[model samples]
Target chain A: MKLTVTIAGVELKNPIMTASGTFGSGRDFEPYTDLNKIGCVVVKGVASREWAGNPPPRIVETYGGMINAIGLQNPGIDVFCKEDIPFLRQFDTKIGVNISGKTIDEYVEVAERLASEDVDLLELNISCPNVKEGGVAFGVDPFMAALVTGAVKKVARQPLIVKLSPNVTDITTIAKAVEDGGADAVSLINTLIGSRIDIHKQKFILSTRQGGLSGPAIKPVAIRMVYEVANAVNLPVIGMGGIMSGEDAVEFMMAGANAIAVGTANLLDPAATMNILAELETFMRNKQIEDVNDIVGVVNKAAISP
Target chain B: MNQSINRSRTVCKIISNRPLVDQVFEIILACPEIVKKVRPGQFINLYCRHSGRLLPRPISVCEVDLRNGHLHLIYAILGKGTEEFSGYKAGETMEIMGPFGNGFNLDSSDGNYLIIGGGVGTPPMVELCKQLKGKKTIVAGFRDNPYLVDRLKQYGDVYITTDNGSAGFKGHVVEFIEQRGLKGTIYACGPAPMLQGIQAYAKKHGLQAYLSLEERMGCGFGACVGCVTKVVADTDTGWRYKKVCKDGPVFDAGEVLFP
Candidate 1:
């Protein structure tokens, strides 16, 4: 059984991509695993202009999770265009550009620029915590989400996947709004908003009081949200949050996700992307599945059905 | 993309075995691949046994002996993970990866180099000394009779300072630097206060200074941006962040924004 997946017009050998921020522009993890083997590689988050990111203590490790406030630190759009994106094009794997912005125009500007070029997909990441305006603001509000989506949709020539933030009262509403605004697909449950305090230091480990949480701890919430958004919106859903294993990947697939992105897992294991791809293949071979897409939404609700 | 790194290692010995000090022994199986690649300020990540240890421990590669194929790692018994690492011995293997991350870039062109290291931080400077083949003065500070300086005598000019003056210099390493009229580039590592003093001294004299910082690292590699040192850019905002594990474990003293 071939575990091939095509999301929002881009073909993926597998659904496991090293999430936007976790994997550094294909340089760090290139040593551990074959970059071409694992589905697509979503490079680091790129902003319309250059960004220096946040202050010190960008990340903290909790019991089962890690909190990060890495404020979308990238070399900006110009550098990405001239330096990163050009280097990324050399790889055979699908290249998805994750874009973030402070204003709707910034988002559109980045999307418009990316659109002019040939990219497999564009993921609108609107969940950065360190930024003041836009980011989570656009994500939490369904109207703002649609507005940004609509703005980018007008000029975006490549497949647009609106990455939905999990920091909303009702994510389903935002999901539908973005779908209505013309998103080809949606990747759901970006890091949940959370914080950790140190008793000894008597202050937050992260200089920023709160940070977005991701890792093995957030998998359940991510899956539930993916299911919710999947039910609400008609677009294909890309699910992710603490997907560490193939079984976890399958769980998301059964929960109505068309594909999944591996975020925090890659940090835990250097070779996680390729490892999950091989594990997914092994799973397909054992289950005797013909096509990987057929398993999407194939929920095992034996107890619930009975 | 190349699937394997040029250098890699495995932890052959663990050290729940108690040493004289509150330290753990993570004796690496073979140091050849790692030792050959490691420079002064580089570190190795010892993958401890999966008995509850989730994060790999980042220890300064104290001494690398390519001939014996052993890299000695002495870590303070901080937690359960480190305590467990101190116990394991020969034949038992733990995943060890490295000679990873950028190291100290020391340029001793003038041959007039001043080296200062505090406590456990002195070990890394050993390699830096080996590379220096000229008039170099080493000023090492320790709490009491920590076994770092006694063995470091063969490197270059050796000067020791204990907190209680149980060692060489009665005061501090900086005192020795002041008394000796140590000039030229200064390379320092150790506790924050010592590094800060060195930074201030360098600033006063307008001399070049570099310092290696230690942070509570989660990944040792850049993946988990846990270990971070505050750096003040000379620009308008006057400050930025750089990963100590990646961007530098060693940096120009003038570059660091001391809190």
Candidate 2:
């Protein structure tokens, strides 16, 4: 069975990759599972300079998932290149570095810096909802999103994947915008802007009063958006948001995603990617499917007929 | 730090899950792997099987019976996750990831050890008092109806205080310590207000104190970087984020900013 899927000229052993921000350079999870077994490990979002992030309580549990306003805290690019990259290079799996910034210049600088690095892919994060500056700013507007994508694509040596925000009304418009600007691929849906109030305290649960919602609760919305973006753009689509099982990954593939990244599920189970990979393989073997790519965009047309 | 990084994850069977008071409960797990490595202030990220509750609950190690291979976890039903844990019964096995985070630093000091705890924070102190070598005095504060007094008594001189004066002292635990004029190396785990109060008292009396902080955790290991506490950095205008899970659930009272 062929599990390998190529995205923007980079060949992954499998289509399974850990979503950015959820898997932190694969260090802490080394004890629970081997990093090489999975297709790729996308490290946490890193900026040109260190960000202190927000103050606690930054995370809160909702009904089917959790909300986080982490503000993309990370050790600057120098530290990441020196420490994180070498550590990740020891593993056999491909490495995808998730890059974020407050301004267009900052994004370009980060892309330029990682251009000479050992990473296989660069995921430009223009859609982080927690931060006040730069995150949702570039994401909410199609022109700004395309501008940032074009700027990064000019300097990035590795293939660039623009992570899309779900806060906007029309996601396909933004996907097409990034595609028009020369983006190698696009990943969605980042996180929906959400909030929860503490009834007894009469205050917001998150310190920031709002956060990005991720987990099982957001899976259906993610699938629908992925389907839309996949049909709208020529660029390869990486679908995410609340993927918990191998079957869920398969569903994303059916929705026309070339690959799937597991985010909140990693926080729930440290070995989630490995388990999902095993389950995906088992599913293929059981169904007598030889190539995994055969199932991509295989959803029945009549199912969604009005 | 590197040695502590790869500590094993275990699926241990629950021996008992019973309530101690109105909202608090004690859970004993039959996992020798985790019991062998746990220290006074260390914690375990307990996985809950309930639907929709994905994150693991970070519960401090209350006690460790090495002989019987039982790890004790004392936690309160603060939210939906703990509420699910409250329903867990004996014979059910759950996956636990820790023995993570740095425990209380056991130094060879020349003073007496004053162990203080408030509310749900009292659990970790049970193990600390039991392991300390020198003179120990345990002071526990509760809103009302104290539990685990007998277990604490085995380690040190136990002092209890409740909000309604139903127990040993009438007021807060910090006030009780001040009233007794106890001066020694202090260790504490409690609500932010209580820890802040203790920090002030420790500064006034010039006593060395260690405090355990609680934050909403993601990975329960250092990876997520979700559980961060502000600390003094080396620069002039200095405050940087440190992982509460990796750097500490316990930090020196002098270095930590309670706000």
Candidate 3:
């Protein structure tokens, strides 16, 4: 009957957390779902200074997914500490702030600013493709990823969780690199780079011409990457990408994710995280499973006979 | 600037869905709760059950019939989302959220008001026309066939135009307004070009105006920040991104940047 799992020393009542950028500090979704029920609330990416983001037409829908180039638009860290932290403190859930910047210094400054803040965890965003600067640069290479992870870990008062990019050739190398760099935990598969073109206009749908693809279409790729990273690294893994239901969370857990995040599904429905958590609890009861942790990486625990 | 407290998504029964013009259709949902709360210019996000389409379609409230508790919506087929909506029939259900977005700022109800709509943008003006307390005139422009004129006529003096000269006038909405020498506090919604023309014209004539805008959106709530529009900001860049879903599908015409 227990659903508790700790992510990097932070004790969460359950393993359910809203993916950063999709939950927006829980202000807009306050009416849609109960924040108290969730285990953790991960706010969107914030930088040391405000980012204007890309021009209009930032998102476009494809077959089973959507692509976005929001460019990590935010009101900056000062605004987050003053506004978001106080609002989230009113909730019963643990707070995880997603931090991003165009340079290593900018990223470190943001983490340092939140060093004395009330956040429970800090998720470093190094995979945003819409921006022209440091995010993709630091994430695509293992050495750069480790460097940023180490730099932020030095200043961050809260436990640091490095969010990884799926655009690289090998995700495991980056996972292990961060582990060696002193990262408390690692969250993976932050959107695959993709694009959509308008046949009639003969132009790209996104203003940036390319964006991160998310939703159900990218689930298979996310699952494969989560499985690989979970096996390669000893650090606890937070798996995400195209998770829409309780079954989706279970699938990620089976693939070695200590916890799973609800991202694109929140865009589909504001209350999706709650519905998913409810379904996950229902799944546990139905299966007669006593501990939720018993199911983590269950697929890898029992390999198929080759 | 925030949503009405404790808003929940509702699966309303589809009362009716039928084509109004070649590609445009009118749908009615049997939800009394939404009927009681919606204001002109507020929108609802319609969720598609199709697995491929994750983002909900935010459509403006065309009409709110409180007596019958029926909410009317008008949409034109543009892509797979609308194409799928076009096929929705009665006896079925739809998942919808909101009455979101700060509704139109209704002020000086007795003042002169001009409501303009271009193509698909005209639908939201119907409810605006009904609620305005001032002397109101509606100017709606269409590409070809003009639908919703009948409903619009019930609330105000309705002016119509079509590109093919199939309706009341043969010119565009702005051209018709200029030709007729009409000036007032204007409210509008339309394509980028049409909205830009209105914003320019309003500024030249020293008139205050409000406009409804559309953008490609992810989470039709504030969270995604994917559907942003350029707005006048006090920052060094002189502008910043505002969520079209949460901040607006409506903004002061002067503050919105056409570029």
Candidate 4:
């Protein structure tokens, strides 16, 4: 069966990609999961300059998922090129860099810095909720979302995929806004705002108080958002949020996502991506499906009023 | 790709899960591959049967039964994940991915060792104590009567300290060290306060020391820059977060900034 899927003019060998921030520039999962097997390795969010990230207690386990306020801690673009890029280039899979910045200029600067670098695509991470500024700001509003996308698109050397936050009221508006701003593709939903209180301690578990929630718990919300966005925009949609198994992946594709990403599942099992790919293939064979892309948006429905 | 990494997921069967003391249990898994590769202080992320609690709990290697191809993991019933783990039956299988993180460096020189572990951290010291070559003295701290001290006693002279004075000395490990005038190249893994006290004592005594740190982790491997600890940095930021999961669960007592 043909598993190949296209996103933003780039033809991925398979529709399976590691969600940015979940996979650490391909180093963390390099041991168990081969980089060549998956469609792409979307590295963690990197800024133009190094970020220290938040203080301790950045993660807490919830019912079906975990919350993280990692604050996009990275060694910056220079380190990414020197350390991660060479390592990833050795693999046959496509590389997608997730860029994080505190301002529109910072976003543009990150895009410009990677402009000449050899990479497959750029994912503008304007939806990270842990930071004080930049990430959640540009993503929550349609104006700011479009503005950041337009600015990054102008300078990005590779096709741009704008990752959207699910914390907003209207995810479709922001998806359409990024599409208007020249985003080659749109990926959603980037974790719902979630919090956990330690009843014993009677305090919040995470230092940030609220963190991005991703896991099987948020899968249904992601599907709904993916379905709506696919119908609302002409841009290709990359669906992600708590995808754990091959069956869950097929469900996302059927909900109108051209490709799907594996996020929190990677943490639970670094081999999750490879396992997911095999499971997806197995699913296709069992269903007598000839091509993987043939199942995209199969759960056809008209866009609900937004 | 570099040729060194061979990490993969394996479903290992449990051989035993019995409580050694109040709320503390020792689980033995018949995992030959992991036992063969596990160093003294290395850890494994153990998964439970619950679908709601997704992330696997990180448990240290308590002992290595190389002859039987068994791995011992001791854990306290602290949180829901571990509590769920406490109920696992012997015949049931658990999925795990590790032998991850850097284990303690049993530096071969001089080798007069002072192994210190506190509370739940004490279990890892059992494996560590077994591996040390030269003079070994182990000090473990707990809230009450110690459970693993017997296992530790098999390898070295074991000292115990309790917060309630119900067992051994009525104090923390550092206080016990002060009373005994303990001096050696120190190796320790414990809570932040105990580790900080050890760092200070080691610095004041001018002794070489190694520390294993514990932090809230996101992914037990290197992804998700969660589980970061402050470390001394020379850059403008002065101190930066190094992944406790990757850079350490073990660090030089001197290099870590407990502040």
lDDT of 2 by residue, B1-259 (tens): 1111233446789999999999999999998878998998999988777777778899999999999999999999988778888999999987788798999998747558889999889999988888888888999999999999999999889999999999889999988988888878999999888999999999999999999998988878886678898888874458888889999999998889767
Candidate 1 Cα RMSD after full superposition onto the native fold (Å): 3.1
Model 4 lDDT at residue B144: 89
Indicate the worst ten consecutive residues by lDDT in candidate 1 chain B. B1-10
For model 3, the DockQ equals 0.57
- Every model's TM-score: 0.91, 0.96, 0.97, 0.96
The interface RMSD value for candidate 4 stands at: 4.8
In candidate 4 chain A, where is summed lDDT lowest over 10 consecutive residues?
A297-306
Off by over 4 Å in 4: A301-306, B1-7
Candidate 3 lDDT by residue in tens digits, A235-291: 889999898889899999999999889998887777788888888988999999999
Angstrom error of the Cα, residue A299, model 4: value is 2.3
In model 4, state the lDDT of residue A37.
94
Error of 3 at A189 (Å): 1.1
User: In what order do the candidates fall by lDDT, top score first?
Assistant: 2, 4, 3, 1
| Per-residue C-alpha lDDT of model 4 across residues A1-306, encoded as one tens digit per residue | 898999988999999999998988887777778889999899999899999999979999888998999888999999899999999999999999999999999999989999989999999999999999999899999999999999999998899999999998899999999999999999998989999999999999998899989889999999999999998999999999988889999999999999999999888778788888888998999999999888998877433432
> DockQ for each candidate?
0.34, 0.46, 0.57, 0.60
Score residue A199 of candidate 4 by CA lDDT.
92
Interface RMSD of 3: 5.0
Q: What are the iRMS values of all candidates?
A: 4.5, 5.6, 5.0, 4.8
What's the C-alpha lDDT at position A170 in model 1?
87
Model 1 misplacement above 4 A: A300-306, B1-20, B23-31, B50-53, B164-172, B216-218, B223-240
Task: Report the C-alpha lDDT of model 4 over B1-259, residue by residue, as the tens digit.
Answer: 0111234667788999999888999998988987899998889988767889877788888899999999999999998888898899899887776787898998758578899999988988988888889888999999986888778889878888999999988989999997788988898999999999999999998888889899887778888878999999976978889988888888998889986
Candidate scoring better on TM-score of 1 and 3: 3
